[model samples]
Target: MKQARISTGTQDLPMRWWSDAKTPGAMIGGIVSNAFAAIGSNRQRSILTMLGIGIGVAAFIAIVTLSQGATDSFTSKLGFLAQTITVSRARNATNTSLTLSDRDVKILSQLQHVVAVSPTISDEAEVVFGKKHWSTTLSGVSFSYLQMQNVSIGSGAWWSSEEEQSRRHVVVLGTKVVENIFGQTGIDPIGQTVRIGAQLYHVIGVIEPDSLLGNDGIYVPYTAVYTPSKPNQIAQISIQVDGTDNLDTVQTEIQMRLGQLHHIATDGSGGFDVTEAIGQLKQTQQQLGMLSGFMSSIAVISLIVGGIGIMNIMLVSVTERTREIGLRSALGAPPSAIAVQFLLEALALSIISGGLGLGLGLLMGYGLSSLLNVSFIVNTSSFLIAFGVSTAIGVGFGLYPALRASRLDPIIALRSF
Candidate 1:
């Protein structure tokens, strides 16, 4: 403050400007103006530094957006199915198996909160409909499969309980199968005999497409087409809850019941795995968040590098403008003004780069969302993260250089030229 005082004998550009100023606003305004002037004078160097940060931020947004979209894709179709829980063989390094039997399905169905339980089995078989031979996946399930899955029948109907009880050779065709085999001429496939493997089965219904339930699979009777190759290789069980309020309780009950039925020790992981859509969705969200943070950190490292570049450039600016700095100090420009001027220059550079990075990142994120077929979200968090990082980088990297600029000895600086 003392150093900024006019010598009381000289009137110059900065001295005259400050001598009449009633408030600190004028000084602050001058500092900002000078900072902009300096940045504009070194366009190439500033642009290159900005490029470093912009590239990093863009990559960060791209990675997060793409990964988040992938997770969204995983949960989108099954999101409404959150009320349903599935029991399947444990997928792990130990390769644990679940031996689900009729008794287990019965137990699940009899639970107070359980609505319906559908046991599913899958097998690949060759189908022939009047010499139009095609190989298709055959899914075997209980009579309640369509009801539990919430899938609709397009034509005819799910087999009657009498048909299922008598082990009748009834099958259901997916709409795609109907189109492919029947040439999509609106031919009715009901009551037609389709040869599956060595036997011909009656197609009793066709599955209609419902976005809510996703694509219903080609279905057949458990006794008709699919047989377990391994002795106890029972397929998955889909359990629909009567309501969502007690979903957790229902899941816990199922786990406990299955554990007791399998005679597995309660101290370890269950031999069977129960999968809930909401639970998986939450897990996927957490995993994506972690992955986004980890990957974004790697990309944000470039901003640190850009900050170093700004500091180096500011130090060089001070060195190159030593005479200007000395003249300004001699004319009563405060050391605080010099420091703030340099800091402002760094801040300006960062803000410009940060904005550029933000725009590029949005563009990249939009492209990723389109490519991955998910929602594009550019909310306040993105702006805050970017600008916050920029401001921090400016303050952190510009401090030492600003101090050096402010502390320069006027006489020595004047003599440097």
Candidate 2:
């Protein structure tokens, strides 16, 4: 009797059970193995559930990334427009050609946020230097026009205020203009005399290739174009503002003031069109935001459908596995373990699908960005948000079915099987 008791001791049984139960890794592994085997039994249903989740998550990521890419492209291209406001001629009832006068320029220069008002005239004409002559587009503008266009003189200097005020015959030539006239000259064109139309002007400065005219630019004093009948006439007026923050206010003020100045009513026939690049950028951003928001709704709907599908499949799985569950329960498996097994199956499907969707989404986003010729923007937040949401969907939808499985009476389940 003593030998039999030693050979069949409960001590070894207790130690084996305790080790398996207390070790979280071993316990979790077992649960995972059971869940995986159950999922493997219904390969088609599991694949369908994963596919649904993948599509939803992929759409969410793709839309956000694509919208950001488009918005970034517009803003980057029009970066300089943020600080500039362009005023152009618009014919009213009285005049066939509307123009801004010297007084208009003076008034705008005094407005808040207005850095400088550059009055300009553009014409195509021939320029002669000594024995050489070249045809180029001539721009008559104030000295401040250089500052407005962010132009810098590569050689010599711009017109002094005194020279501009005195209506002096001075000109600034672009690098290309110089090359066209001087043809790789050994000497700089500064201080040289150039003939524009019937007038002879001195070249006071030369701009590097960085000026608004690029390689083919030429500038003259605004006053040089003034005549007895049109002493202060300008074809275009460019208002350089401080920044883009208050562009609408600045534009409104300019419009109201100009409207009053020109005696045109506000209801119709305003004599000028005030346009800014930053305004277009803002509009683009707003439109892109709306588009992404609309697409996101569709993505969310897909996710909800995917979540519902998971719930339905889990319920079916619980019903089909009644016999196995009953056998496990009769063999001493706890209700908590039964519930966790089903929950793990659902979570595993959601997370794996989410990862697959993330890869597909990134690839889809970059492909669209390339096709649209925009920058590709990677949003890490979208990935985290997608995975997090998918996990929640799994847990929330899987809970009901898990509870049903855990609550089944072993005797009833066994009898059903």
Best by lDDT: 2
Among all candidates shown, the one with the greatest TM-score = 1
RMSD of each: 6.1, 8.9
Which runs of model 1 end up more than 4 angstroms from their true locations?
Answer: 1-22, 67-76, 80-82, 88-99, 102-104, 129-136, 142-194, 201-217, 221-223, 226-233, 243-283
Q: How far is candidate 1 from the true structure (C-alpha RMSD, Å)?
A: 6.1
Model 1: per-residue Cα lDDT over 1-417, one tens digit each: 532432212112234334555678876776676677678777888898888777876786677666666667656655557788888766651534557776787788998888777777777877778867667777878888777666677778888667776789998887667767776446678988988888889989888754233343467776564344554545788888877787988888887787688777452244777878668767867888888778888878888888888899888888877777787787677898888888998888888888888889889988879976677766676678788888888888889999999999999877765
- Give me the displacement of residue 105 in model 1, in angstroms: 2.9
Which residues of candidate 2, in runs, are more than 4 Å off? 1-20, 86-238, 245-280
lDDT at 248, model 1? 87
Give the local distance difference test score of model 2. Answer: 0.79
- Cα displacement (angstroms), candidate 1, residue 168, comes to 6.3
lDDT to native, each model: 0.75, 0.79
The C-alpha local distance difference test score for the whole of candidate 1 amounts to: 0.75
**Prediction 2 TM-score vs. true:** 0.62
